[model samples]
Structure formats: C-alpha cells, structure tokens
Target: MGRHREYDVDKVLDATLCVFWRKGYEGTSYADLTEAAGVERPALYSAFGNKEALFRRVLDRYQERFMNHIPEALGMPTAREAARHILFSSVELNTRSPEQAGCLGINGSVAGSDESEPVRQALIDFRAAGETQLRERFVRAKAEGDLPPHANPEALAAFLMAVMHGMAVQAKAGFSREMLEAVAEQALSAVPGGGAAPA
Candidate 1:
C-alpha cells in the first residue's frame, strides 16, 4: 500500500507557486522548491513528479486561484467594462503580495533554455487562451452594439492583453499601485467609447 503524505499537498503547492511566481521555471531549482515548500526532495517527487510536472500543477492552481477575475471581467455588460475590470484586477493582483509581486503565468516561463521549451510553450498557450476569451467577448460586444462597428475585436483584445502584460512587468519592477492604475486608465483611451465614462 502507498504511504500517506506527511505534508499538506495544498500548502506545498502554494509555497511552490510563490517560488515559481518570483522566479521563472528555468531560474528555479530543486533546492529552492524544497526550501519554499518545506518538504524533502523525495516527498516532493513522490507527490508531484519532476520539476516540470510540479510547475504545471502549480500553474493549474494559479489559474484556479488568481485567474477567476478574467472570466468575471469577460461577463461585464460592455467590452470596455470587461477590459477595465481585467486591467484593474490585474493591477490589484500584481501588486497585492509584496513578496510575490507580478503574475505567475507571465513570470512562469517568459524566457528559458531549450530544455524548458515545453514549459514556455505551455505558459504561452495558457495566456493565448485568455486572449482568445477576451476576443470572443469583444466580438459579442460588437454584435450587441456595445462596441463601435469599426472597432476590431481582435485588435482590442490583443491591446488589452499587451497592457496587462506590461503592467505585470512594471509591477514586478516595483511600480506603485497608483502608477499602474494610471497606466490602466490611459490604456482605456484606445477602446471605443472608453473615454465616455468618468474615471
């Protein structure tokens, strides 16, 4: 029979997630993970497999815990509101935790060695999925006349994502919340009817 885990799996994953968030996959090592998770190498391997596998599991947890705002934002009444929600929420999230500032997905694998290509691609695909969701939501907004007919849903979605990504990088660099908020506000100008609402 398999032995029962002496450690809490969720706690280990959370600690590991913070480590991954602060340092990219390639930047992190088994020693770092073990130190953060407070678990032995053998136990971590038994519970979550190799480094790549453990990162993937933590990535899933990040989505479940932190990315819920995206879906909620997408459901807003207007595309502008949806974009605004995502932007502001991102600002809050990116700077909320001082020890782990920035986004897990973006910080996870933006750049890495050839051996980490699969992990990098996984992060890319994960981000692309969010962009696709925004694009679809904007398309619906266009159809509903919430957005101008001339406004390109695809471009708008991409633009919003770019702004969010930039904000994440800025947050990692220690940009203040107010500064990020200003950035988010300025980005709204590009959205059709974005300036119509009072800030």
Candidate 2:
C-alpha cells in the first residue's frame, strides 16, 4: 500500500505548478519538484504516482484556474470582442512576469524535449481546444450577420491562434507590453466587426 501524505496536497500541487509554469516539463527535474513541493522524492511519487502523472495533475489545475479567460473570451457578446479579449488576455498573462514569461502551455510545448512527448502533446491538445472554442464562436457570429459575407470563421480562428502563439514567443523573447499591445491592435483591425456598434 502507498504511504499517506502528511503535507497539504493542494498547496504542494500549487507550488509544483509554479515550478512547471516557470521551467516547463522537460526543464523541471524530480529534484526540482521535491524542493518546490516541500516534499521528499518518495512522498511525491507516493502521492502523485510519477513525474508525468504529477505534471498532468498540475496542468489540469493550471488550466482550471489560470486559463479561465479562454471561456470568458468565448462568451463575449460579439466575435470581435471575443478575439479582442483573447488577444489582450494572452498578452497580459504571457508578459506579466519576467520570472515566468510566455504561457505555461506554450512554454511546455516549446521547451519540451523528445522524452517529454506526452507533456508536449498535452499542451498542444489544450491549445487546440481553445482554438476550437474560438472557431465555434466565430462561426456563430457569421451566421448572425456579425461578419462580412466572405469572412471564413475557420481561417480567422486559425489566424488568431497563430497570432496568439506568436505573441507568447515574442513575450518570452523580451517584448514589452506596449509592443505586444501594438501587435494585438494590428490583429484586431483585421476583425470584421472590430469597430464600435452603431448608435
């Protein structure tokens, strides 16, 4: 039987999430987890199974708490507003901390090595889900006459996703908030209904 953990599991997991958020999966060693989680290696393994399994749990928590903006953006009144929300939110999250610049998911996806395929794929899948939600929202907008006749929701969704990923990379590369905001502005201009509604 596995030994019961004496530490606060949620608290430890939250700490572990910060380690992964800063260093990503491949970069986070078991020693790093033990030190960050305030637990011994055996205890971490006993509580969370293995490193991969523990990372999966951490990723889930991060998505739930830190990624709420994705859903909030999708639920906005207009598709243009939705895109604007997502773009700005991405910039905010990716650039808020020099200690953890760029997104946790994108950081993992970008930094993960071959041995970390599962971790990389998990981030990719999470990102794909966000794109799917945005695409569906844009599709609804097109049906409701919010978009021009020739606008393609699928392409627009892909474009926004690409721009977002680019923003993450740029943020990691030391671009400032003002620089990223300019990029967001350029992307917003391409949105079919980006302007204010008629009086």
Q: Report backbone clashes per prediction.
A: 0, 0
> How high is each candidate's TM-score?
0.95, 0.92
State the C-alpha lDDT per candidate: 0.89, 0.86
Error of 2 at 87 (Å): 0.6
Which residues of candidate 1, in runs, are more than 4 Å off?
194-199
Candidate 2 has what TM-score?
0.92
Per residue, candidate 2 scores C-alpha lDDT tens digits across 1-199 of 6656589999998999888878878888899999988889988887899988998898899888888889999878888888899999999999988987988887777544676788778888888998899889889888877777799999999999999999988998899999999999899999898544322
* Candidate 2 structure lDDT: 0.86
As a whole number from 0 to 100, the lDDT of residue 36 in candidate 2 is: 88
Off by over 4 Å in 2: 1-4, 111-114, 194-199
| lDDT string, candidate 1, 28-129, tens digits | 999999999999999999899999999999999999998989989987878888888999999999999887888988788666578899899999999999
RMSD of 2: 2.0
